[model samples]
Target: MTKETIQKTNPDKIDSILSDYILHDKLHQAVMISAPWGTGKTWYIQKKFIPSFESQHKKTWGVIYVSLFGITNFKELDDIIYHQFLDFYLSKSIHKKIPSKAIRFGETALSIVFANKLGLSSEDEMNKALKLIPQPDHIVYILDDIERSGLNLGELFGYVNNLCEHENSRVILVANESQILGRFNDTHKDKDKNNSVNTENIVTDEEKRIEAYYSAKEKTVGLTIKFQAAPDEVFEQVLNKVVDKREVQNLIRQEKNFILDLFTCSSNNDTETILNLRVLAFIDVTIADLYDSVKQYLDVFGKDNSFNDCLPSMINTAKNKIILDMVRYTALECFKFKMGKNLDGQSFSYLGSSNHYIYFLHIFPFVQRYIKQRIMNQDAVANYLKIVLKEEMVNQRLTKSVFPILNEWWLMNDLKVEKAIEQLEREEIPEGVGPEYIRGMMITLITLRERGFSIPIQHFTDKIIKYLNSMDKISFNNSAFSIVSIFANKDFIDLYNRTMKPVYDYVSQRLLDASLVEYRFLIDLQWDEEFPIKCRNHIASFSSDRRFLSIVSAEKISDKLKNANPGEIWYFCKGIREVYNISNVSDFYRADYETVDLVCKVIRDLIQQYEKHSLNKVKTSNLKMLLNLLDQTREKME
Candidate 1:
């Protein structure tokens, strides 16, 4: 027999129970023990009640310890108890009987054997059978972990009462009160003996029982023990246990101190304090994930030989530092390795890595400072100014300054420059900026030709032409309209047709449009003869204009050239160039190598067109200088 560790607040309480049983000859078939988890309810049954009762009496008692874990239905309960009884009565001999169809009936038959042997049988035949069997003075049934049995209190208590009616059994049901009481009330609602006790009655009776138990044990017991953990108690215990472990002690100490300070400074009471303490406990567990990797490293590589092995050097390195700072560099490297993102803005690879060293290094210093400040001063108010400063200095610098330079030098340089430029030209501006804002914008515009609106090109050109006409500038070469046209091809062609056609029609309507300069020039113009004569007349008129001549002489015309609204004449000139450039005829076709030769011809034509007939002789020198400049530009472009 072993002594049970039943907790009694008062020594007189146990004495009263012994007096009731011995002096008054009082007997109880069932007793319910209640307490919270880790509150020693099972300890009381096994260490105090069972051993003491067996030692005090001369008669033998059978003790059954049943754990009701996972006992879902009545069948499970019956099976568990039956198995427990078998173990308890291992020293006793009993007749073996095979079960038939009904399990419940079979269990009832087995229970009768113990009752009959105890002289509890009512029938004469059963009583004769009971006389033949050895009698046990008492049966001590200990149900431990009864909360897992899923039995309602009413059903459980009712079962105990029935067992008591049949056998000389003392039932001890040990369970955590918090897990059982709420469930019991929700499931069972009977007024008769079937109900264990009313909720209010149960509370009052439990208090009285607790009071009696404590009073009986008052003299012998040194002190009543409470197993529930208080916030401060748990904090001190965990901190003491972890602060010297070498591997994780530093981090755990910091976190523990943080939690303690939080509780000390908080206006809330015990419950809220415990909740916050639990949160800090969770953070400690997360920090341990980092520490575990460091431990593994040290274990694989001997600690003495690991990371700056020389004691003097290590001490020098750690000057003006806390213990947590010892592993700060390692932690940071681990975080980065595990959590860094690639240029594609994806995190899959980093998160999948075994070590998150870099991320740890980046975050640990701030976390360390936070813990140190909180613990040293019990600071309830957090300073966000540091966070703001870090965001501006560290994060912003890394993103804006470092990332762009690195991306351009290392990644973008590998891409085709021309292709990249084309991609940019085609890119669309997204509603909001994307992850690769510049690159994605360029690619999107290249894919979709239209800009902000997805309307047809003709509509966009019409809008631009209307805007160009409204501008104040009237000079054809310098107008904002010409710049707009050169930038926008659709607008250039539309405006060119509007401006050039009237000039050609006015000349063609009169016979004066004819001259050897026009007819012999037409043959020399070597226009793609396939075009209608009216189109050729338009081209000639456009070529004859001083503004158009000036633009041709410049070689590099401003974007404004496209916005001139040169009417039919300008469109005719563009059509003639495109047709002749692509044509197969020797005189009409221009070779790629001769583009400079053709550009020189266009400059000479522009000088002839722009110089007034009276000023032509004097402007010849200026024209020769201009031609020389064109020759230089052509050589450079080649």
Candidate 2:
């Protein structure tokens, strides 16, 4: 028999965690916190922990937060600490005079800056100000972004050591330890392991230097606490900064779990991909900035665009800032006006070469528009890539993989039979596309088929059938793709009805197994607070054709029709309407055709009588029925 224990980290309880770490300390010396970048090392301390400690009404004078990034020397560090110390004193509500010796130095320099008196040197004054700050137990010093600092390592560590031992200072060093260790070799060639970083594993001088640096850090930092912030909390805060929390929440409500599912599925448990804080922040801002514009465009013209490989490919790109930047770059090129001018070209300017940035932007949007316009030839793709980039930039192997990938993405985004036919008409389409690729595209087709696109995919469908037969069933029901871009376009729906219908049936059944299926039941069910998720399209799969949401003369119908209160009228008819009347749901059909149009007109008359509203308002009949139904149903249910 064996006993096992597992620990799941709760970012919400970070305050409690910090309390344990901080209160456990007896050293009154430096306490270092080490966390990977984007784990919210600085945010957690400044926002949550320090405020909490301050709120306790204990002996804590004030906290001074300083980021050491870009600090070039000891003098620069001294200046920052001196100003922060002064700011700390000034933060108090009550006015307090500086000590006599400090008054001239602190006030004179501060006034010079505020008054815009440029020519004066604040150097001697700043040094004097630094000496006056009490380096004792009255304040907490938060030193962060230390890994990026340009200050000499020995001198920096020496200053920290002297502060604790003689000045009675309490320091909290927040940094990424692995990152700082990596920088040590780059900066000090003397300790560069036998002149090569690759030889680091052999007991070399570089390894010794690394060990010595760790030893020095451990000595300077009396206690080390691993720090990580809750990604969810940080995401919420980041999103809330851009849009109202309720709106953002509503936008992703259904897909929130799906986005996380996408994240987990794509990462394959790679810690860097799954837990990277920077990526979390990037996604937050991306959704904030891109959601409304992309959504608006897609909603009106969305039939024309989809984020094919881009959405799932998010995981692959999250590992590098450059890859993430590529997404932003492409979006900016297309929708620059909406993007705001904050970027000012600085992000791209930092990249060593403009070729990668310029070429990717041109190629990315070209691919999206190319697929949307239904140009399916591999040669077309190759020629298009050539037009977009220089000759050397086109990697043939990459383009080969990318061409099919673009095709697969096409299926995911916008797969009307009209567009698909261009690609599907090849003498042997399967020869150019992969089984995995085809499987993914078929799942996209199954989704559009369910949503009511009357595509004639079943006639002579051996091309699709042969590919599907080779694989186990594709489960689209729970996929993120299954939840996006559903529409009621009868002109494009096949509804899984055709000669090759069995395959569609098998795939359809698999996908609809979890959805709210029956039109009557789906309607009659009470709307819970969480019912009708906001962002996700909960696509309906119907079991009937002449579903009655009709408004007609109250006279000719059965007594059952007249006796109906709005409760019975709306229940069973909310989403019920004739999309098309063909026996085969997927048959070549359009709602505007004679039979479909006539049925819709007749039904509209029936529904109008139920409401007793004027025919002039026929356009609002369906909506009126639902509103009246809700009013009456609430009365009935309550």
Candidate 3:
């Protein structure tokens, strides 16, 4: 029998087990060590447990370490165990060719010989091998990350039981119990109850199986040791190594209390803390991905638009950034909670219940502070917020309609809400939204537009009307409302109309030219009528000068008409069809074929001229059809 020394940070437990094995003349072969990841499981085993056992037992006791990761099935399990056994027996300096089967057979035979050689000869060599060596005899095997191994847990337990019962050998399985318990429970439930007769029989079977395993192998004990996160004292020791300042260490200690509060308030169990840390690590990876994506976008698009502009260019872009940031913030908060710190005490600030408000508030303050600091110090803080709020009124209108949706999604997950409220409290802000709140309004608007929401202009215009009506009820002094109103005033509205008119005219002309103007577009236009009319009459009357058209077409009307098509010549002409369908332009639809043909000819000619240089690689069929349609209309004009 082998006498092993137990060297561990927590050596009392180890000594107790060793004492048990020595007094009973048996090896405690099967043991399960459970702990979470990053808990020093591997360090304890490699540095202390294995060395202490090997040093004390010497020639009698052998130690083997096996990692059970990437072994998803039972077949891999056999190969892994066999390989570990072989590696343990073969000297590190001896790199000679040794087949796995030879190693397996050698382990069995060598144990028998070694038992006899050690003066433990009793009955047969194999029987002697089964007996523990020296006083308290045991061999130790260390299994790491057993849960991640993807092995059949029940089958693994069965094998271990066999080794303990048959050979008087001990087996140790180390894993994160939180990760493995579900799988272990499921696997155990699938076992056939009737296979073992009774509970006592089952226990006896396991013991016998273990004994038989050791009889063939040698006298070995498995010690399973679970390492947990260090206590406050140990954590302080670790922190002292990482951080130099005593003040920072004290701050960390104080913050740990806040973190503990977050954990206790939000997490369902201790396992959640581990999961949260893993998630935070993932979020760090995602932040890197987002930064790379922004870098690439800037590289391709030029530095004229800053990183923040990438969000507001499209709804999709904005949504992606918001979602990514939210996830990242949540993960970061989770990490803080796990580490026993509050995120509110960190860099994050919570806005009121409105997500849109939060989104703008979070980003705007950073932008404002950055700009202020840079301007004051001549530093190079990029003005991204300037780009986002390039036209303040338009931005305000967009934000007011969109912020509710973000707030709704923010509150979807209970954990998110709890964390958000805690963060808000830290920020000294009110907790959640009030009643009668419009949830996900912006998301609805964006989705509607993407799904062929023909009336974004009208939808936005109507929302403006409602907003204006609600002005009396809404307190403009509120930070969120104040920020929004700053961008939605008359001058801002005028600028937005001026900036957007060209896009609208371009779309309208495409519709008229195609003879596809419809009622929906007209109705949508009605909502915009008040704004455009107000702008044109009071602020600026936009001239429908042909000079702007000249940039689109340089040739004569006749020359342009000569190159028209029958079906569709312009991409914008297709837009006309959609506009007409959406707007239900009855008169335009019911116009005489000659008038329609003439309109088509004019529009087709204009589109062709505009696209002439651009359509160098256009399909031949499309160009020819466009030309034919133009020619037919010109004949009518003549």
Off by over 4 Å in 1: 1-25, 38-59, 72-75, 91-137, 164-166, 191-290, 295-638
Q: Is 1 or 2 the stronger prediction by lDDT?
A: 2
RMSD of each: 30.0, 26.5, 18.7
Looking at model 1, report the run of 10 residues with the lowest lDDT sum. Answer: 348-357
Candidate 1 structure lDDT: 0.38
Best by TM-score: 2
Per-residue lDDT of candidate 2, residues 127-244 (tens digit): 5444444435445677898898996565567678776655555667888877888776555333354645444433347777687676566556665666545545665665565556
Candidate 3, residues 52-133, lDDT tens digits: the string is 7677665776565788887777666667666665555542323433334432421334444443344445566445433322
Model 1 steric clash total: 60
Candidate 1, residues 1-638: lDDT per residue as tens digits? 01223453322254345324332322434444554554334544565656766676524455667777766666677676555555334313335332321122113232564544444446664445333322422555667776667665455656665554455455555666456544553444445566464565432355554543333223222222222234554555444443445547555555343334333333223223322333344344445544543334323322323333334433332321222532443222222232231111111111111111111112233334333232211121122222322222222223222222322322334334334434333433222222223222222222233223232333333433343344443222211111111111344234333543433343333223233233343233432334335334544344333111222322432122222223322333444343232222232222222544565676476556656464444344444564574465445434
Q: State the C-alpha lDDT per candidate.
A: 0.38, 0.44, 0.40
In candidate 1 the C-alpha lDDT for residue 306 amounts to 31
Better of 1 and 3 by lDDT: 3
